[model samples]
Each structure stands twice: as C-alpha cells, then as structure tokens.
Target chain A: MKPENQTISPNQLFYLVSVFLLGSSVIFLPGAQAGSSAWLAVGLGALEGLIFLAIYNALVRQHPGKNLIEMNELVFGSFLGKVVSWLYLLFFLFVSAMLLRTFASFFAIIMTSTPLMVFLITPLVVSSFAVRSGLEVLARYSQIVLMTLVLLFCLESILLAQDMDPSNLLPFMDIPISEMLLAIQNVAAIPFGEAIVFLIFINLVSAPLEAGRFMRRSFLFSGILLVLYAVRTIAVLGTHSTISTYPAFAAVRIINIGEVFTRLEILLAVVFLSLGFVKGSVFYYGAVLGFSQLLKMRSHTPLILPIGALLLNISTLLFDEYIYDIIDANMLFPLYSMVFAFFLPLLTLIVAKIQKRRIQKGE
Target chain B: MLNVFLVIIAYILVGLFEAPGLIRNKYWRELSIVAVLLSSSLTLSLLLAMGVRLPMIIPVIYRAFVPLLTWLGIM
Candidate 1:
C-alpha cells in the first residue's frame, strides 16, 4: 500500500468522523424511540457506539496505515481475503446509497418542492467534486461544515429554550424495558454502528496515537448533543414528537419567540444539509477508496462520477411511492446495518487477533 | 409513475456524463456503475408498486409551521 502524502490533524479527523456520524438521523431519533424514555435509549445507544469504537480501534492498532481491505489480506489468506474485501466494498456502496436517499427524502419533505432528483443530484455532484480534489480537501471541508453545524445547533437551542417545557420529560422510564431496548437497538444500528466507515480513514490521521482518544471524545460530544436535542424536541412537542414524522422539523417550526423570531426551520435545514453533505462525502470517499484498492487503480478520482451516477439512481428508487411503509414498518435497514457495521467488523477483528496470536507463537 | 421515470432518466444522464472519466482504467468503476443502476431500478420499481402516500401529519405540521415562519419574517 502506498503511503498517503496528505495528512489531516487529529482535530480535523475528529470533526469529520463526528459530523458524519451525527447527521439528520439524530432528528428522527426521538420520534423513533418515542416515549419519555427516549433519552435512555440514546444513552444505551452511546454505550453500543463505544463498543464499536473499541472494535475499530483494535483493528487499526493491529495494522497501522492499512484499511480493512489490506488488513483482510493480511489476516486471511489471499483467496478468502479478496472475497471478504469485496463484501466490505459492497457494504460501503449500499450505505452511501442509503445515506443519499435519506438526505433527498428529508430535503423533499422540508427544504424544497423541487423534484427529489434535483435534491439528490446536487449533493452527488458536490461530493464527486470533493472526491476529485482528494481526501485532504474533504477533511478541510468537514472542519468548516462541522463548525457551522455546531454553531447553528447552539443558536437554535438557545432560541428555542423558552418553548421547552420540563414537564414533558416527566414519568421517565415509564416504558417497559423491552421496548426501551428495541429503541436503543434502532439508534445504535442507524447512527452509531454505521460509523464503521471510519475504519477506511483511520490511517489518515496525523496522530495515530490520538485516534482512540479523538474518537471517544467526538462520539461522547455528538451523543450528548443528540440527547439534548432529543430532550428539547420532547419538551417542546410532548407526545407530538412521535406523531410528527420529522420531530426536529416540527420542533423548529414551533419556535416562535415573541412571534418575531420564528420560521428558523430553514436554518435547521441548512444545518441538516451541511451534515448530509459531510456524511455523503465520507461514504462516497470510502466507497471510491474501496473500489480503487480492489481494482488496484492508480487513483480513485476517475471512478467518482460513475459511482455518483449509480448512487443517484439508487437513492431515487430506494423508497418508491410506498416510502411511508418502508419507514413505518420495515426493519430491514436496522437489521442489515447491524450485520455489516457491527457483526462483520467484530468478526474480522477476532479473526485478525487469532491469526496474530498464531504468528507470534510461531515466531 | 411518470415522475419516477423522469427521475430515472435524469440519473442516467448524470451517469453518462460520469462514464468517460470512470472508464479510463478500472474494471471496478464499470462494475459499480452496473450494480448501482440495476439495484436502484429494482428498488424504485418496488417502491412505485407499493405506492405509499405521504402521511397527512407532514402537511399539517407544515401548515402549523407557516405562521411560525411569518412571525420569524422568513416568509
């Protein structure tokens, strides 16, 4: 594997991964979990996220500078290694497509009446441009976007503070443990667990020793932010949080400070759009890198557009007219994400560790 | 249905523009393009067949938000 000439500071890498992990998905979390216990579910989900970070850190520590693909070859024999690598690559593409669809769906619902295709293609085009420039450019862009998102989040929270009611969070833990576990599972799989893609760029960090520390801090920070926002939504909207399809949007819509400082949903949209872009670009970058490594291409740039086109098509088709049913009932996304993001990576780490022990004994 | 088809056509156009640079020297790019198109088409077809309407609450909330917007001077 060739060494990457460009290096990103630990903080930039931290923001990139943090923003990618925390996107518009956080907005729906309260709705999905519902109940006053939603905060507990998010807390449980954060624990699950820590477990994932542990697995990711273990893998990176073992094979410095090598991605999951290269590590696959090192741990498994060439034949099986290539097969596993291909599966991982497929997972990356599917996730990128999923994120793209989610972004477009949110935009269509809240931001604009423009056709879904327009919303979808805009980010794909922008992502393709970022990929063409390379990973360092994407890192720099993430730094700027993440900072803006944080600022907007703070401003929105401050402005909406008066509308928040403490009574909404009353009777906490009223839900059965079983239902709370289910909600936690949903959050874990969708947002935190799906962060497996960070494995692809762990080696790009300028300070490898700080990788674990940065990941932990960022995950905690984002998790806290998500929890506070979820609390705010529940406090403002009460049980309406579950009834509203997009609780965050509705929460923002309810912000009427003296009637003079309302309709700031557009600000929320901008924040969501920025987070979506970072998420899409990270996934896009990971998929392109996976393909480039798989085919042994000199650079990943050439493949960016072709991949972007395919993602656009997939995004549009993912939730046809029956999208409501998909969101309301289907458990496929959570199940599939857990398999690819959590189980598969954990399995790979186990295999690698076993192989390492064997080699050590032989030596 | 027609709207969905139009969206699909737009995607194809985007793909066509991307093909030249993608095909310069890699089989994975070509393979990915095919996979994306096929999977997306299949998913879209399934979704259209399901024909789920947007829920009523979305618009109700949108209506609710309108006054809030006017108050905020964003409208």
Candidate 2:
C-alpha cells in the first residue's frame, strides 16, 4: 500500500465510506426493534455517527499523517501502543470474518446445495485480490459497486411503489421508548459506528485535513439511503419486515410490475454481494495494512492471502447458531461494538490532549 | 476426503503463486510470516473439513458479554 503515492480523492472516500456503512445493514436491517420506525433510528444513527466521525477526525488532526496504529504509538508509548494495535487488529479481523459470514449465510439462502467452504473461500479469494491491489483499487471499485447498488435499489423501490402502503409507516412509536433507544443504539453501533475503521485510512486521503468533511458527507448520504431502504421495506412488507430474515429481499420479491419485473430478489442479492465485497475488502485491507505497519514491513501484499485464509477459517467455523444468537442479541452487539469503536478512540484522544498540555507546560 | 485434497492443493497453488516474488525480493520476514499464517490456517481448515470440532474464540467473547448484557435486561 503506497499511502504517499496513492491518495484517495474526496469522492473516492465518499463512495468507499457510503458503501461500507450500507453493507450488511441493507440485508439484515439492524435495529429490528424499531419496527416501522427503524428509518428514524437510522436517521438518528447517522447524526450520532457524525459525532463519532468528529472524534476520529480530531484524532487524525492531532496526528496529521499517522494512522490509528501509529497514533496509538505516539500517544500511549510503544509497548501499550502495540497492545492497543493488536486489539484493533483482532477487532478488524473479527469484523472482516463477521461480514464474510453474514454474506455466506445469505448465499446459503440462495445456494442451499453448495457447501459452506465454497461460500467462504470464493469471497475471501476475491477480497484477498482486492486487498493485495491496495486501497486505491478498493475505493475505485466502491464507486462502481455503490452506483449499481443505488440504481438497483431505486429501480426496485419504484417497481414496488404500487404494492407499497404508505400507511405502514404510521403508529411510528409502536415500540416502547427504552426499546426504541436500544434500537437506535444498535443502529449507531453497527453500520454507523463501524466507520471507526475508516480512521485507519484517514491519512491515506488526498487531503487528510478535509477527509472528515468527506466522511460526514458520506455518512449523511448513506444514512438517507438507508432510511429510504427502511421505509421502502416497511412500506412493502409492513409488520412482516420485522420477522423476515431479509426484509429487503422479501420486499423485492414482491415487486410484480406486470410480470416483467417480478422475482427481482436477484437484484437485491447482487446489491448485497457487491456492498459486502466493498466492505469486506476495506476491513481486509485495514487488518493487513495495520498489521504490516505494526510489524514495520515495507508492503502488506504478502499478508493479504494469509490473513484471508485466517478470515476464511474464522468465517467458516465461527458462524453457527450460537454465534448468530449472540450477534442477533442487539443489546450485546451494540455495547460490545462501542468498546472498540467509541470508547478506545475517545480515551486515546483525551490522553493525547492531556500529554500535549503537560509538554506545553514543561516547555 | 477429496474436498480436503482440493483445499490442500489450492493452498499449495497459492503458496507457489506468491512465494517466488517474496524469494526474488529476499523478503525473508514476509516469507516466514506468510508461511506461518498459511500453515496455521491450513491446519485449522483441514481440521474443519474433516469435521474436527475446534474450540471457538467467539464463545469466550460472548461469555464475557452475556453476563453484562443479561444484567442490563436487554438479552
């Protein structure tokens, strides 16, 4: 990864971040508790995501050219920094594997006869190639993939418009306030807070100082798109959106435009696969790049496939019924995600600020 | 059993595909890391292919959080 030579444009950053934020969330629909009001939770989650992005950007501004691992070293000293970086490496790997498994399960729905390892290996192989080509390639790919997703999403929604009952969005406060808050927290932690990984790539942007603005814009873009998806799903599927494993796919299946546009669920699958690829490659790139940096290696290229193999192993064996239960347990998932996403980065920022103040006083 | 052979062969092909470049560059450290990662993942994958029940790490993470989430009444 040539960070200095290969700088990501603001638009590339926007597309990458937008696709990543909208990844598995499109299929799984985080914040199921919000029901028809899930769109509101996504809206609020984007607002909260801006605050999270602000903290990440502040960290970047504090250490202009340094990535998360390097910033940890500067702020916490080498030993503690290595420990924190290792934890983040694990987090990234876990996230990569989780995203891989999410899509594999979705694949299983379509290809029931196919073996699990096939689903796991194929994506990892593609993502390994993507990660090996480096971040710029991944960002370039996101632009095309995100555009396709948006177009397919719009076409499907328009086709389903006839079947949509706008009244389905009524009685918005169906869930209790506390549960609604939890649902909002789930939305924030997932697809939104997951943007914390972008901190690692912030310094790779053409103008690191302005990357935050791009990220904020992408968050708003992805948020509005997700809100539209939520509303469309609710409008098409009604209360059944909460129960369907894939509300978007089910709703797309309902798209019967004079039999010409019926059975449009394949469009949803294509959208999910493309979004998952972009998201997976980003996380995959983050893990390998960050680890290589931690190891003081010149290139992360060799590590890509090996780490990909590890991801394959994790995705294949780690995702079962019990793991699904844990992941679907909205309470645990959000709180657990916040530890790596919000808490650690905030702590690093505060400690860095305090250390800088002390140095100024000493000077 | 054949599926396991295919997997092993696939890994071998990947190793063959990548090793020459590393050897040419004399990136011995990278080669070693790649060797470690590939071998470990291969061992785990082969075990999985054979239906060997490997211990999972996620359950430990879940155990750590389950108690806390349960206490919050959000489980």
Candidate 3:
C-alpha cells in the first residue's frame, strides 16, 4: 500500500518503531519522576503504551489501507476530517520542534564553546536529507542506526555495571501514587503518544494488518530496553538519579573501567544524538507528507526545507532555555498530547463505530 | 553583529540551494511556501541576533490549558 516503489517490509517496520520509540525518552526518562520507583513507572508506562497503541491499532485496522488523514475523512465528513487531519499535522510539527529543541540544548550545554545554532541546524539538515530521500531509504537508514544503538546501549550498561550498588534500588515504591501515575503518564505521552504520528505512515507499509503484529513486538522490545536502562540509572546513581538533570549521562560519566574506559560518556552522547535524529526525521516526514496530501500536491519534496526552517525557528522559541524545556516536556506535554493521542482518536473511533452500526442495520 | 551576518548569509545560501530546483520544476506553490517560511525564520533569527529576547509559547499554552488540567486533576 506504500506509494509506488515505497513499500516497507514488516521487519523494517519493526525496527523503525523500535528506534522511534527509543528516541529521546530513553535518555531523559530515568530522571523524570517517581524517585527510586522510576523503573517501576517505566514498566507501568510500557503497559500504558500498549493500551494507547491498541487504540491506534484499532483505528488503523478499521480501514485497511487508508492512513489517519484518510480515515478521518472516511469517519467524519470531508470538512471535519480535514480539520482533524490538520490538527494532527500541527501536532507533528510541534513535536518535531520540541525534540529538536531538546537535542540542540543538550549540545549547547555539553559543548559550550560552540554556538547553539550549529547544534540546532546540523541535525535538522541531516534529517532533511533523510526525509527528502523518501520513506524506503529512511527505513533502511533507521535499521542501521537502531543496530548501532542496541550495541552501544548494551556496552554502556556493561561498562557502568561496577559502579552500580544494588542498595540504590532499595527503599523503592516510596513515592506517592499520584507521582507514580504522573511518571507513567509522562512516559506514555512522551514516547508512546508520539507513536500517534505513525498513523500517518499507515499506507506506507506493504501490509497494514501486519503492522499490528510488528508494532506490538516493537513496543515490547522498546519497553524492555527502557525499563532496563531506567533500572541501570537507579542502580548506578541511586536516589541521586531523582535529583540530577541527566542521571543516565552522569552515571555514564563515572564509568571508570580500570582507569581505561573513563571517556565512554561520549558514546552515550552519540546514542542520544543519533536516536534524536531518527525521531526528528519521522516527525518531519509525517508533517511534510500530511501537508502535501492536504494541499492536493503531487509531491512533498518542496516542503522538506521550508518546514524544516520553520521548525528550527520554532525550536529556538519553544522555551527560554533547556531546563524550562525539560520541565514543560515532562509536566505539560502529556495533557497536551492526550487530545491527539487519546481523546480525538477515540472520538473518531466511536463516531465511526456508530455510523457502521447504522449502515449494518440499514442492510 | 557576526550573528546577524551569519544568519543573513544562511538565508541567502538556502535560497541559492533550494530555489533553482523549485524554479526548474515551476513549483509555484512550493516556491511561495519556501519564500514565506524562510522569510519568517530569517526575520525571527535576525531579531534574536540583535539581542532581542523572544517570548516563548509554552507559558501561554500552559496558562490556557491549566483549567482543563485542573478539571482532570492532573495539575
């Protein structure tokens, strides 16, 4: 069902979802909330993600080859569907900008000598190249990146093992229920809610039904990786993980493998940057593709730059600085994202279901 | 300021880089969108370069959505 010459295999789709889900959340999530119970929150969050993905899957399964944009029109009238589609596109662009802002700020903080714009522009530029090359290329490229990420993630955990004290994970589940729920919601919203964007890719797969199987598989794998990483952060950094801005990174910095592996934090940075790039590219492509379809344009190529520039500008103005950005993405993004991920889609599903029953009764 | 100079140069280079193919294909809508978006980005970039502080959108959104969040009991 992918555009002419653009079909991706279920295997490719599996890895694509894996890398996309792991993107930024894999880095900042351990430090988000729930204290020493943060890893528990991650586990619960993965379950929550499956629930959200279930909703997404149902929406896509209802209609065989149509993407979300098309489904809205099919469910609602053209006028209302177009509005819903437009909202999703705006959400995509906004998320792209936010992710870009996150990575750019990290670069600025780490390499203080370099100008911030360099950090902002470099990834956008690289991601634009991926977006412009088309979906098949992007899928192949992401598969390679995910392999490197998995390898590096394992190596980093192994190197940081000695520093971890099992006592760190003790005295857990002490956080209040509300705080735990908030942590779960943050994980649900930040990584899994963003999976809503993949609805835009429904038609890009060879078999949309096969998407559900691979999506579930990908979600399980991503969930395990996230949980493992969160535990590693807790074990290594202890309760200190709750307070620091970047506990995983800080823990990685203390990776002193017999005085030889001290500089391995750079590998962690590379992991974050590469994953962020994959995440941003998916969002960028979603926005461009959706916009072109809305406008009835034959090609989405022209949009790759203007929208990139628009997003880059928006990234700079997203928040005053990094910590504020983090606070907003963690605290505020969930409530904002739920509309697109949950409420709006649920509305579409209910309305579509009723309409189907009516037609069946008429028959 | 060097920041201002570098930004304006960036605007020009992007134009030089993307404009020709758009023109060759005679993509008027694409060309216009690129023009508008580039101009918007360039204008904002220039303002920031000149030591002007840009107000962020997050606080406004946070304000607007506070009521709903309170209702949901998540805030």
Interface RMSD of 2: 2.1
Native-referenced DockQ of model 3 = 0.59
In the range A125-201, model 1's lDDT, one tens digit per residue, is 88888877767887787788778877877888898888888898877888766567667877777678878887777
Model 2, B1-75: lDDT tens digits are 986998899899879987998898888988888898899999988998788877665665777877887887777
Q: Rank the candidates by lDDT, best first.
A: 3, 2, 1
Which predicted model would earn the best TM-score? 2
Candidates ranked by TM-score, best first?
2, 3, 1
Clashing pairs in 3: none
Q: TM-score of model 3 relative to the true fold?
A: 0.94
Q: Mind listing the fnat for each candidate?
A: 0.07, 0.56, 0.64
| Interface C-alpha RMSD after superposing true interface residues, each candidate, one decimal | 10.5, 2.1, 1.9
Model 3: CA > 4 A from native: A1-5, B1-5, B67-75
Q: Which regions of candidate 2 deviate over 4 angstroms?
A: A1-5, A322-329
Model 2's CAPRI class is medium
In model 3, the Cα lDDT at residue A351 comes to 92
TM-score of chain A of each: 0.93, 0.96, 0.97
Q: How do all models score by TM-score?
A: 0.82, 0.95, 0.94
